[model samples]
Target chain A: MHLLEIQNLTKIYEGKKVLDDIDLHLKKGTTLGLIGPTGCGKTTLLRIIDLLDLPSSGKIFFDGIDITASNVKDMDIRRRIGMVFQKPIVFKGTVYDNIRYGLKVRGKNEDSYETEIFKLLDSLGLAGYEERDASTLSGGETQRIALARVLITEPDLLLLDEPTANLDPLSTEKIEKLIAELSKKKHTTIIMATHNLIQGQKLSDQIAILNKKIFQMGTPEEVFLKPAHKFVAEFVGVRNVKKGTATQLEPDLTLIKLRKINIYSISHLEGLVYASIRPEDITLSKMKVISSALNEFKGNVKGIVDNGGLIEIEVDVGEDFTVHMTRKSFLDMELTVGSEVWLQFKASAVNVFECEC
Target chain B: MSEIINAFFQAINLIVSLDPEVIEITLRTMFISLSSTFFAALIAIPLASLIHFNKFRGKRSVMNVIQTLYSLPTVLVGLLVFLLISKSGPLGNLSLLFTPGGMILGQTILVIPTVIGFSIIGLRGVKEEIKELALSLGASNLQTVTTIMGEAKYALLGAIILGFGRAISEVGVALMIGGNIRGYTRVITTTMSLETQKGNVELSIALGIILLSIALIVNLILNQVQER
Candidate 1:
């Protein structure tokens, strides 16, 4: 059974629909990374799931109990789950007091939790800093303190809204490591919302793409490698999007026509469509090679970009298509600007969706 | 000018010598006003929280009314309390008229509006996210209220201090409600008023200095609290 379920959750803020009929489900011990742009209602959805805000129309079930029911005691359910807000919100007190606040509020004996609080502090790399004023700390320190305060609660479910948005690299690593540890516990379910695509993919077992609702949700590989729509593809870094007209072919093949080129993809989509392929999915070679990749285009590398560990080579094959590859591969192939190259990808690599051109 | 200058010198001498009557009046005034402020804050803070947390019709108008009453006439409050505790009045059987308790009652009524008005503004100034943050951490509705209240503690204390200032400095309630009885109910303001009226200008000036000093001390604390 799913540990948490949201059915048709719609939230309207001041006469505008912030979240539009979002449906989501999470099993026990699953870390679902919620990714979206700003103002996409990530915080709003978290608020509703945390039971801190009511949805305009929806039903949320936690532990097989409908939490959105009028008779349900929200505090009882909210106590079982905990949320760390996007901001590093700390009370006006010592770090010790801030970390122990959740325990104290839930009626736990403070003296008994003193050892636990210190242990949490040590794990957060904030040992010996418990005596410091929480409000006086830097942004990174405050974020760690915020995480420590919530992690100490041992909530059955956790909601983190952009947990690593504004932190430095070191603090981000620490928080990410902590979240990874929590994900492996197998007793704590986490739903973390983040705008960092790489971080979300690395830290979450499942990923949900959202705009006003759940656009697509699956394993990181499924969502990124094979997006369900144009928005999901573009958001997940599929930059080879081209509007084309597709005609259905037998044996589950769809022939699409781009400007002055014909490409075949294994999809049922026909008519005016949007076809996208991940940059890395297209193999770039110096010469035409016969292989399983049926869609081959001969073009010149118009631009070469060094992206840290990787390289992005833009090829102009009638339409400029960006291809991603390792720097080592680019160096080995001696790929440079204005170099002739052949782009090849399998028919299945092209994700075709029926949408307005 | 020479007579007023002599009175100023005499007033400084009285203040330096720490006149017993002046000290007694100052102590009595401080006790009654502080007690009234304490009791009034005990009532007004929670009342202000209730108003802030709940959505009710006419809430803005209610706040407007409270803010308007912040400068309510001291004699009007005195007359209202006088009516309640006067002989043959509703609460007359307690014989509280002309007593320190009656004076505290009148002062409390006079200053409740100040505390409530200031507290409402303070609570409103607290960020909305603080309450939501607390609630997300498993806090019940009441616990969240306390969290917000703690966030605005400085402002709330300032409210009480302002109320205490109002209670201590007002003369009409002290005079009309307590009758300014000698030694029993005489306070700084009523005694200062009486002394000035009886041509004992030097004593009144000395008491006025004491009142100014008290206000200065209160203002200093307010500055410290707000700076934090």
Candidate 2:
């Protein structure tokens, strides 16, 4: 069953539309990753879902009940949802008092909850720091405390907005692991906004790429393998793309034409097209080699960019094309700034998209 | 030179001896000033918070009125309160003309605007992101306000101290409204004025020393509290 649903959500500020006709749905116990560029309404969407901002016009249903226009008194819906902001805000008090703020506001002062609070703190690596001043904590420590503060409430849905944007790599890894473990243990539904695509792929069960609109939404594997729009394909780091008109020849084979170049694809697409190939799918050879691959282009290495473990080699095959290969391959081929090479890839590796021109 | 030395030694002797009349006047001064400052803070802090946090029509006009009131002369406030409490005035039936309550009323009117103006400046200086974070945590409007107050507690305390210091040292309002009645409303400043007019340097110097000591103690306590 759908746990939350938003329909036709629109928000306008100062005669400009910030959010335009956004629709989304979430299922129970699933993590949804919201991926977008900066200023792409991701945080605004989270704010609307948390009921911090009223939509210009929309219907929001949580637990099969419409909660639009509800006031703070009618906040049973809010009780079931908790949000962690991008920057951790620790009140001016001891860490224990900061965590106890929400509970105290709700008129709960039982000492029995302290045990659970301690356990949560321990799990988030904040043990023995309850009585410490909140202002003395580091950025990562504060983020953990913020998460621990919300998780102790045991809300059914947890919303985190860029929770690890400011953390070091080790802290980021720890937080990602803690999130995964919490989901498995409590069946908690999580909605997180992230600019890190690799982290999104590792942590989220479902991914939604939001541009000016909902560019695509599906399971991480489904969205990564079959992006419905060119924006989503590029956002997920699928780099080698050629804009063309696509004709479906069969269930597996298609034809794409760009200017004077006609390319055949074993993937089917119809109408105006974007033929995308993951950079890793193409192989670079220093010399001509025989291969069963149907598409092989002789090109010159226009540029080589070293990005951590992989080398991104831009090949000019009578047209601009990008090919990503391992650092080992570049070193073995002795590829340099002006190296000549043959780029080979199977037709089946091309992802075809049919959308408006 | 001998008379000046006599006055100074006798002033110290009066304080050490805790002379009844001098003690009574000093105690009355402390009571009136502290009570008025406390009452002003109680009314001003929440009013300032409201004005700082919410948007409303006529807000600029309201702020302008507050800013104008903030610099209102102590003598002017004394005259205004004096008219209201005088026998032929609007509140004549209450008979508060020469009482400590009348002095307190005048001082409260004088100090309230100072407290409110500084409190508004303090609360307004807190970052907007902190408020948004509290709101996103599903805190109600009251909770948000409380959080902001907690965050700005140091600034608010400083404002209260400033108002208290101003109220305690203000002699114009206290002298005008209380009328310096002996054993009833004769406070430190009024007594000092009367003693000096009669050329009695010992009692006048004693009262002056008490007032300066009280002001110094208040300032020291404020500094210590702020340091913490």
Q: What are the Cα lDDT values of the candidates?
A: 0.90, 0.84
Give the CA lDDT, 0 to 100, for residue A73 in model 2: 46
Instruction: Show model 1 residue runs off by greater than 4 Å.
Output: A243-259, A266-274, A301-303, A306-311, A325-340, A352-357, B1-18
Model 2: residues >4 Å from true position, as ranges?
A70-76, A284-292, A299-308, A326-342, B226-228
lDDT value, candidate 2, whole model: 0.84
lDDT of 2 by residue, A100-158 (tens): 76676566764778998888788877889999999899999899888887886777889
Instruction: Note the DockQ of each predicted structure.
Output: 0.69, 0.44
Pairs clashing within candidate 2? A252-A266
Chain A TM-score for candidate 2 is 0.93
| lDDT score for residue A85 of model 1 | 86
Residue B77 Cα positional deviation in candidate 2, in Å, after optimal superposition = 2.9
Docking class of 1: medium
- Per-prediction TM-score, chain B alone: 0.98, 0.92
